[model samples]
Target chain A: MRKTQPYAFIMPSLLLTLALGVYPILWALRYMFYDYPGYGSATYVGLDNFARLMRDAEYWNSVKNTFIYAGGKLVLTLPLSLILAVILNKAFRGRQLLRAIYFLPTIISASVMSIVFFIIFNAYNGMANQFLMKYHLISSPINWLGADYAMLTTILIAVWGGVGNYMLLFLAGLQGIPNDLYEAASLDGANAAQKLFKITIPMLGPVLQMIVMYAITVALKGYESIMVFTGGGPYGKTDVMYLYVFKQFFPISADTASMQRFGYGSAVGFASAIIVGVVTALYFYFSRKMDKIY
Target chain B: MTSAKILTLVPRTILWLFLLLTAFLMLFPVALTVLGSFKTNLEVTVGATILPKVWQFGNYSTAWKAANFSRFTWNSTFVSAATTVGTLLVTTMAAYAVDRANFFGKRFYVVLQASMLFISIGAVVLRPQFDMMIGLGLQKSLWGVIIILISAHASIFFMLIGFFRGIPRDLDEAALIDGCNFYSVFWRIVLPLLRPALAVCGLFVFRGAWNEYILPLVFTMTRPELQTLTVGLAGLRYSIGSASETQLMLAGACLSILPMLVVYIFANKSFMQVSAGAVKG
Candidate 1:
């Protein structure tokens, strides 16, 4: 009776998972092999979708864009967040206020943030370009949303919105460290540089790993900002894989020629899923290995 | 001693400087947006000014009307509240069962939870789920979106359960000895002890539902009246064409964020504690 009662308690969640989670994945898998419009008659086209994805130029472009975006975010945001975390970890007046201010963006809606950034980075009347020209930092306002700078601008916005949350994560990790370790290092006459190198970084390994994994996952799934700010515009310069998949399903252009190939889009979705899955798996493997060592 | 002190001071100073610069960069967009919200359209287009020459308080009222802010706010509140309460109830019961019960498929449950964590957003699976919902006659409904939110958040609920397991079993035993049944013991004893975890879990579920975009965007397509704050904001941003209208849109954006800002300010300390507890556990 005791055991059976527990099963009853868990049954609701299990049923929900089956209904909403497991069944959906299975349905997608089934649909992948079929020639189905989003809302039309379906026919099996076994392997045709997969075969076309192998040679799709747009799909490959999306793959390249995903890598660049993810790489850019990891390189720019991670180090900056780490540095900020270290500084905020120190004793200072008004540190909490600063921390709250820094973390403000994380709590806001991404779509809203994207809109705010779009206005600030607007080509003709943006504050960024106006400030630059006012100070003679530029001869004229650079077109930040143009093809030449769109992806980089998108990256900057992403990093700015992201750094605060990661900083807080790292701050929490830093707080968990024993103060006595720092005292002991000070007794040994270690300079701040030595203390950071010898003690702080090593102690923060687990937190760093967690942050990196999160950053990579978020970067790989980067879509909302692109969707709102650039709409993968200016010759598809900012088009990442997720946006490409979204476009394939809901093409903005009304021309039949420009209409998305849902069959091919599913293939793209599957491929992106595979890439993210592999990366996440590798992250877990490495983290687990490191855990054993530590 | 003097050389060592100098070297230590230099690195600390440099680190502080670097942090201050980064913090400025991070805070700039938010600060600028707030400034933009208060500016007239003409001032907004003219240049970057720290303070608006003409502060337009009416823009807030205009934005609220333009976006149909009341409808979106109500929809978001209802959906988010439902999700939070449903998730807490379902997750706590499920977690209790997984942790305390001697079940036959416990390992399977564990694997399911772990896989849910690692799987990406399951975007590929979205259409089929939509199809299934359509087949079941649930397309373009608020309830459909609520159900999706609950399902999507199950993994986090399981994580909270894992945290709950860290609490000792002796508490449960003592409660049982006081003549409480499993449900009573869970409600009276275990559930009360899980407040911190529940708060963190509730906040996550609330935030996720409140800020959710794509699912509601896709599922609630036919029903404009059913849109959440995120989709409403997206539409508002897209529709505003003129510079003045854009300034008005910024006001709308500020109005949308005002509730969350107020909540965060009031709950800042508890929010931090709950979030830290979730991660650390």
Candidate 2:
């Protein structure tokens, strides 16, 4: 075979990738320097989009919200799923059935999860309010998707919708550990907690890195659920980075934002992508370093 | 029983109980949605009943027709099928070339695929891509959505790459020595060996494309006729304004979820094994 044969084989995907992924990224970078109200009406306004973003309170708030959501999901999901995986790892009746049930959420469409969450947390007679009020946990039904509670509600739903997928990953990690390690630990008189900390965690270093990276990236980029559930608001409290960019193009309502700033939104998107890229790269680099140390 | 045995037994039983409760909590929301589809929205929201008092079977039909789910499903099927075929062809050739073909820029393709997984921010690209799609005359068409869906799913490489690496390179050489061209070697020998991986990757691509929201939503915004199941269901949520029609929404959600759920159950073990392997890899 010719040396270029491989190139020929890969050209289709590479071209598609270029068109879909790389071209858009470049287009975004170019759009950053312009004032694009809509197509074919762009004006050369170099650095203006960047200047606006520097002072744009709403954009910065969305950045802050992205971090909060991402950080919360990372902190909440990793340990939660790890513990669940550990519990499910034990020899018990109905373990397979339970495992399947836990994984069920991962299979459901994001729209469905969003809808269910929206209804459950609906201010009036929603199941969440009913459940909480039933237990006297709160004085009254809280409008969970309302401005005051939107971020919290959004984060919880993200966790609920996401945990099952990560739990299964953790479960796979647990199953990968050699039985002999646990046996040796048992011989050393290690308790369950000790075994978890010493054997399971140390063994799961790579998986932990993978999961953390996934959780952070997912949390940062997640918008569909929030869009469906809250529409990024009661105000703009629940707006994350991606949702902010998305709403820039497709505003919450037509009359409210008649002038869509396509150029500005693209600049924000480009900048956020850079931030995410750097953070993700930092995570990968440090995790690889951790691998070396271990 | 001895106190030692009883102590272990007691804790084991406690653990079992705790796990049982956690599992129930996990399943409760989804179960409620499925069950709620059978009842009026008032019963679902106003009361927390495990089962409907009188099962409302008409909700599914009402949702099915009202949401124009038949159109949605047809579009979804077209997009998903096209995506699956395109992805399989692209991934298989790409994987083969990367694994076997000792060509220039081999390293570049590998790195490119990896970066595709890492640096993904198509959110910003929405405008340009939309414009480009229009330029290409694919805007607001299933083909536009299908093309974009195929591009977005680089993760299908996860299973395929791993599987390709596992196959022996000697087979490729043997076919080459048999006077076979690269395509024949790939098609006749390497591709046959990839049957299992193909099955796993195909299902994943199909399912991902089926569930995809944003791409379809944007591409089909002007043409609701081209909207996928997810886009339709999302629209259905707002259209069912009053709580009286909430069951219709739930039933619609059920309809959207049913195909994937049924497929997952049937392909349960294969799916689990493939994901487990993919994650570990």
Candidate 3:
């Protein structure tokens, strides 16, 4: 009875987690081997979906785009966030005000921000192009979401919105460091750059490692921004792997060529999940190896 | 001035300038939105200006009716509230049990719950999710939306576990000695102490459920009546025929975001706490 009491307390969560969390992966894995349109009965086609995933140019393009998009987000966000964290860590007038204002975007809903960006980047009357043209930066209005710049636009929007939280995280990590370490380093005639490289970076190793895993995973699995902003448009030039799988299931547009490839989509989804898992694992493994002996 | 003073002053000026620029950039869009919300459609679409010539506050009423936000806001509130309450109740109970009691499979449950924080096999599971819900005849139900919102939320449990651990066990023992069973001790003693944690958890979960789009979208696809605010906004047609309705879309967007902004302003301190490693804000 005593042993069972704990189980009783956790029973609801356990059941819900299994039903929603674990079951979906298993069911989707099973679905991956079959060809089912949304309504029709699924037909088993073992390994065919996987084979087609390899051969699918569009799928591969999506994979490439996912990496580029995720990579771009990481490249733009993490370093800038780190810099903001460092700057915000210092004592200054209006520090709290600046911090709060910068944090404003992170609290706002992503859909709201996406809509806001959409208006700002509107083809006919975008503030970005208008400002650029006003400054004689361009001859005419450039389509920010055109194929040439869609992914870049998506990446910029992501960086704009996501930098705040990561900055906060870094700020937390920075605050956790004992002040004595910096003071001790300064006693040894260390300059600001040396103190940063030698003491601060070394002390922040574990946090940095954790943040890398988080940043990479977040960037890799990002779907919401793309879904709202571009919808993987301009002939799928801005398409990412996550959206590829989603479009497979939901069919966002009227185009129905790949609408019925439910099994193939499931295969893509599972495959991408696996790839992400492997990448996350590899990151952990290598980061752990070089995790700073100090 | 001395060169030393000049050097320090230059960097200080540059830093302040940089900070102010970023602040302006951050606030600029919001300023435009707030200003543009009161603009006519032609002004919003055709001209790019910071302020409207004729402030049309009616845009709010028009957009509110156009999107039928009153109904969708109700949907968002009901579903999000239920999910937040359920999540808090369930996770708090689980955390209380794990913190206070000895039990079989406890280790497995804790580890499994924490693992969800990182490894999410996302996007691949939507159809299976749909199939499962549809089979249970829950695809069109508001409860379906609520349940889906409540499910797969181990992160809250993870956060609450910390809160529970911070609680002294002596409190539980004292309550237990006062003619209280384990359940009473939890309900009467521990649950009260968990209020701050609950507020953080509730705020986090409420914000998430309120803003959630795709899951609710897919689950309630068949039942337009059950659509949440985010999905409702997505489905709403801002214009009827040839009229460019940027104002309405902007208005609706502002309306959709108003609740969150209001919540954030009130909970600003809690949000800051959450940001600084309290709940991974």
Candidate 4:
């Protein structure tokens, strides 16, 4: 009993994590190589699912879409959030209120918020178009949800949803930079842009690296909003990798032609996971190299 | 001196303008949602108006009924609460035991947790996870999602472990000397001391469970009645059975945000502090 006491304390979490967290991942690994339709017996189809994955156009398109989406989000969100964080970090009236308001979007459920966005961006009589048209920005409503602009629309919402969380993160990082650095920069007659580039950006290197890594993984994994917003619709133009794989398992979308293909999905999932893992590994490798260079 | 002062004032004015504009952009969608909730459908679709001609407070009740929000809210509350409690218990105890005791496979367990942190299989593993639930006979209810949510405690486990290390071993030893077992020491001494950590982490865990979309979305697919608020609210687009129940959806959106908003308002400091601390490690 004395020897087993520690095990007893850790057993519940150990068992649950093993069962739910670790097991499912191992389970996916095993299922990826089989011809399992989720109900019938899974036959050994060693590497066939992967072979098909290589040839799959839709899956490839999703990979492309994932890059575009993640890239768009990263490009927009990093700069925007950093700027917001910098501005909000200063002593000002209503700073807390402003920070909270910015952070508000981060806390809301993505799917629910995406539903609101769906309404706002609705091609006809939507708030966005209405607002734009009211100000005579355009004579007619742009089909924001149409295939031509759907990806851009989703990217905008993604940036909006994400900018705050990153801003808060930047704020945290900003707190670490000593005021003297900025004061010293001021004393040296550095302008705002110059200080931002030479002092702020360099000072935020490690934190920014982590944030960018985080942003990349999160952007890659994001599908909830898009799932709710477009259901990977308008000819699958907005279908990211996760949404595509999700369609394999849930097939909730009316447009998705395939039903639950567990084997192929597991394979696709394995591939997608590999892609994300590679991206993450490459980021770490490059960031470390940059560390050496700097 | 006057030119220098003017230069400083010019940038200051521009900064203020920029900050105010961003603040407006950030608040506009949320504020609009609130206003739209109280607006007539006709008013919402029509371009000119920002607020309802007459506030339709009844839209809340109408949406609440139409979206089955009460049931969904209850489900969300139950699942989130259960997940939070389970996560706290599991993480705290495990963290306490790991920090305090020398156990078999301890190194391996630590390595496993670390690997789990980095090796994210993501949504790909959902099918297998669901199948595992089916194997356990938990696939039919919200319990499966709750269990999955609880099991994804690697981050929390690590966080609690950090918090646990801050707690002195002398206290545990003293408790042990006072005729208390390890369990009682944890329950009576350390657990209470962990209130702050638990509260911050628990709020986040609750939020994650509440805002979670895909797991509940998939698990509750067969049972519409089991859907949580996020899933239910997302479904409002189609389920309202009209060309557009935009007002109703806006109402549901407001409702879904309320509980979290309240939590954020009260524990605003903790939320900010924890999130800031999270990145340091």
Q: DockQ for each of the predicted structures, in order?
A: 0.55, 0.63, 0.61, 0.70
Q: Would you list the rank order by DockQ, best first?
A: 4, 2, 3, 1
All candidates: interface RMSD: 2.1, 1.8, 1.9, 1.6
Docking class of 4: medium
Q: Give lDDT tens digits, candidate 3, residues B136-223.
A: 9887678877887787678788788778888899988887788898788888999998899789878889888888888877877777
**How many clashes in candidate 4?**
0
Writing each residue's lDDT as its tens digit, candidate 4 over B1-281 gives 69999988999999879888888888888888889999988888874578789999999898778668889889999999999999998888888888999988998888888777777656767776787888889988889999899988888888788778778999989999999998899899999999999999998898889999988988987799999989888777777743467788888889888899899988877777767776766
lDDT of each: 0.77, 0.80, 0.80, 0.86
Tell me the tens digit of each residue's lDDT in model 3 across A78-193: 88788788889888888888888778787766776777688788777776776677678898898999989898999988988888788888888888779998888878888767
Regarding lDDT, does 1 or 4 come out ahead?
A: 4
Off by over 4 Å in 3: A187-191, A255-258, B237-243, B278-281
Query: What does the lDDT come to for candidate 4?
Result: 0.86
Q: What CAPRI-style quality would you assign to candidate 1? A: medium
Docking class of 2: medium
lDDT of 2 at A227: 77
Report the Cα RMSD per candidate: 2.7, 2.2, 2.1, 1.9
Tell me the chain A TM-score of model 1.
0.90
Residue-level lDDT of model 1, residues B1-281, one tens digit each, is: 69999977988688668667766877777777788888888777765687888788877777767568778888889989999998888788888888877779988977886677666533566666676777877776788788777876555665677777778999889888888777887788888888887887787678778877777787766688998877787777655674556687677677667777788887766555554554465
Off by over 4 Å in 2: A90-92, A131-139, A253-256, A282-289
Candidate number that wins on lDDT, 1 or 2: 2
Model 4 quality (TM-score): 0.96
